[model samples]
Target: MTLTSTAPNVFEAGLPTFTYGLTATPHDILDDLRTAQSCAPIAIGPLGPEILSYSMARELLRDNRFRLPPGITLAAQGITSGPLFDKLTSSLLGLNGAPHIRLRKLVSKAFTPRATSRLQDTIREVMNGLIDHVVDAGRCDVVPDIARPYPTPIICALLGAPPEDWPLFVAWTEEIFKAFNFQPDVNFDESAIMRAWGELDDYVDGMVAERRHNLTDDLLSELIRAESDGDRLNLDELRMLAAGFLMAGTDTTRNQLAASVQVLCEHPDQWETLRDHPDLAMQAVEETMRHSPAASIVPRAATEDVEFGGYLFPEGTFILVNTFAANRDPAIYDDADRFDITREDAPAILTFGGGAHYCLGANLARRELAEALVVLTRRLSAPRLVGPAPWKSLLGMTGPTTLPIEFASERL
Candidate 1:
């Protein structure tokens, strides 16, 4: 079942060209996944050539090794020379096994359910301010106004970033997603990224030094105090951990919020369902993750020869977990395409991923979304979309970039 060269004619005529074709694009991935899940759990790639899917992606993420393409990984190690688009394509998420697991675990403590729950009141207040800003503007771009600001404030605050520098943190974090090959013809945003990293690193370094000098209550302070078997984080590890958290929590949550709102806008009945029932917002967010996950394709490289779904994918093969497709698998979800908040049996969506790499930020993300939906529905008198919704071209994280909407005059 393995072929050396590219798979031919597997794509639909006139569809947009992408690594996963319709399966990867924001506009068409959901339907593509529903179709892919039924015909075969694994199929010849229309674009990725020899790539294969671990058909049971949702149930068995740990069954295979996930790594980035060697070429991409090597290229990523030298990110600064290039732009943002070029550097992030091969960033830390590309690592597999020990290194990936180690890095993820080093920072998991901050995103624990207990940790995020403590921030609920703060999250609500943050959402309140952002939504108020939107309402006051009368007509506003929800992406930058609400979606963009919400997550970074929480991340920056948790990381002990200064209030004035928080806006810069949000701007730089947002650019990382755009620097990869997903977009067309634009060079990477290297200067902004390097600048953001330097500012953040210096700030965090000072905070760490200060915390070391005199302990404090913040996460950065805690991380400095945390030790495993008398082993503390080295300076580089702390920087990586801080950088990773900012990257993981900020833009990712922003996209999820924007995508959730876009879905509600596209299906106003769903919006009404959420508005009427309010509780439906929880399930609605889950459905959006299933149907339009923030991360579309997860890249993995074979650590050794492996077999799955009757195909023997060779070692070193670049495999992609088409989570968007797996989430909509008919075998796993009934009527996967229909946005049913009350379906009651939605499978564990791949939005948080699974296995050792499962998102440590899961609870934090959910809590943020819960607060956001609650505040939006409760505060705005009648929140309505005001213009054509446009999506961001950032491949790794795609959502509405400009969602102009109007709320009642009194909502402000």
Candidate 2:
């Protein structure tokens, strides 16, 4: 995979023109985008959409004039859709303004400080149990063995689904996310994606129906009972929210966990620092979020003519905020490219985004990553990567698809 930028012509003097090859990986593309960001905070290019830097990206996300475009659809983009499209487009991620606010308010309770704090013990137990499975083996692939398997169960428990059904959830999510790939030349298996979506939708609908008859002490049940003023989520909204929570909460965390482990292993000094001072696990998680964000890009569309950073963006212009670059902005962090867990004053990264559309599961993700690190460091002695971790080529989400590690066997 190769990415090359041609020298700017006379008219577009300062701006570099990027040309991305079909084989370019997401990280490679991001590297090019970061270089472009350094040249200018905002750049207009021929190959891709306009790219925004850290400050400008933050501004664009917070501004009401920039919104999630309604015209963007899986079907319109030549991808088949069924319940997946309906659920995602109707959920909080797809909406803006009052409707988004109302749904967010209702859903926020499940992710509050108190709520997430209560799950620490559960998360710890889950992580340790996963480690326990591989402790005797002395070697394991962290992605499939641990990271990929951990989050779905935790999210399932929170969503009032059976923990035993996590593997099924993972399978469905894998298929559904295929439709999310944005690389220019990638081809998704539309039939498989739609099939998985239908199965997942029916499964969620069943859970919703069961919950309505007999509510339980779970986030899904609470959402079912939740009322804002005189309004409540309709059946479609309920199903969508439940499915969205599972998908959104699990996917990013799964990738982040794998990426975090890969980063820690690559930088042994940092890993040792974390191992020695277990309290710094959270800091390590923050640093990982900054240095190697799992979700690399966020897309937005201008609702009205906006002029900023010496560029005029007409309404409907799509903006791609390169968070992978923004988090590594040299202006924002001293020695930004280096991964240092001890840095105390690092600014918040755009990994979870900003303003109105900030990730609802941010706290949960932080806790999960921190807990995974704590357990890994505590249970294993100097775990080393088996080889170079292979990162996924997906555009929006970037992380190791396989992270094999070997460590001294230790009893829990």
Candidate 3:
């Protein structure tokens, strides 16, 4: 990639910015930008320059010169050395090259398709249990009634933690994830976030002690035993690794599940298709993600000076690959904006990031989505949005903040 255009550098240029806030705007500025792209391929986003086109975004994500952001990105936002910062340094999110490969390889053992398939039963059990509470309610907020409560319990079960202890994990993950929202100007609470990570670490330490004495066939036990030949996870690695997994596993799935249902409820005929053919749950999840991904942007920083998509991004330049826009690029799909689960052989989605740093919990997240939709579509009928399904900023961990829907419960 070379800079052929004589236009000013993107960082300094007056590039078009999109609507990226909590307030509900009637029209998505991304759609306008998506349609009005005769000039440039990039947009000056809230977090540096954003790659908006599908092809360009894919190229950037798979490129090697682009690496995970440095600590200064967080440090810029007042997160200068805390439990959260330390966790980022040690966890897969902050690591690059050899350390990343090592930890990802060891942690991936518990996330393989076979492992996810084996855990699918637990997913169903948890989904069904949550449904038991809301199924008879007729009208309820999906975020609280279903989505929020669903993923953490499954994560606790995966870790062999007591199901009743899910609330603690949920609280910790929520606080810790706030650190990633990238609101450098906002009054970000550093102490609360750091304290949450410390609490989670303390909990993981207790679990490590208990599980070491009596290991079981759960993810914790698997992490305890996981190793790459001579290399093994030390207590510190295990504690941070498990805590990171719990955080990743919970917030992401919760947001995506809520987003999936909101999309389906908006398209009743699609919901009918999913209900009639429950097997379409897998495809439905794919369509929902592609249409409205809960995990939208994959943040990266330039490791070295590189010209990509005909623009020069100097070393340490922050970039956000806008999957939310890329997923709907007219160049990619025939009917890119339409939410059709029946679409045949849809291309792979970018919701899970890409290449070496692709989400480790992707398989489990998909299983959670598939099982959750299957249970919901089968047990509930005539699902329709009863109130505004308000959404948060797409800048990070995107999803509806609250989704209220009305439905009739089935006798199951």
Error of 3 at 371 (Å): 0.4
Give me the displacement of residue 91 in model 2, in angstroms. 2.6
**Best-fitting candidate, scored by TM-score:** 3
Candidate ordering by lDDT (highest first): 3, 2, 1
Off by over 4 Å in 2: 1-14, 26-34, 45-52, 70-77, 80-87, 183-192
Candidate 1 has an lDDT of: 0.64
The TM-score values for the models, in the order shown, are 0.82, 0.87, 0.90
Instruction: Give the per-residue lDDT of model 2 (tens digit) for 93-116.
Output: 788888899889888754556555
Best by lDDT: 3
Arranged by TM-score with the best first, the candidates are: 3, 2, 1
Overall lDDT per candidate, in order of appearance: 0.64, 0.75, 0.78
TM-score of 2: 0.87
List candidate 1 segments past 4 Å from native: 1-24, 29-33, 49-55, 70-94, 136-138, 174-181, 184-192, 276-281, 392-395, 409-412
Candidate 1 has its poorest 10 consecutive residues by lDDT at 7-16
User: By the lDDT metric, which is better: model 1 or model 3?
Assistant: 3
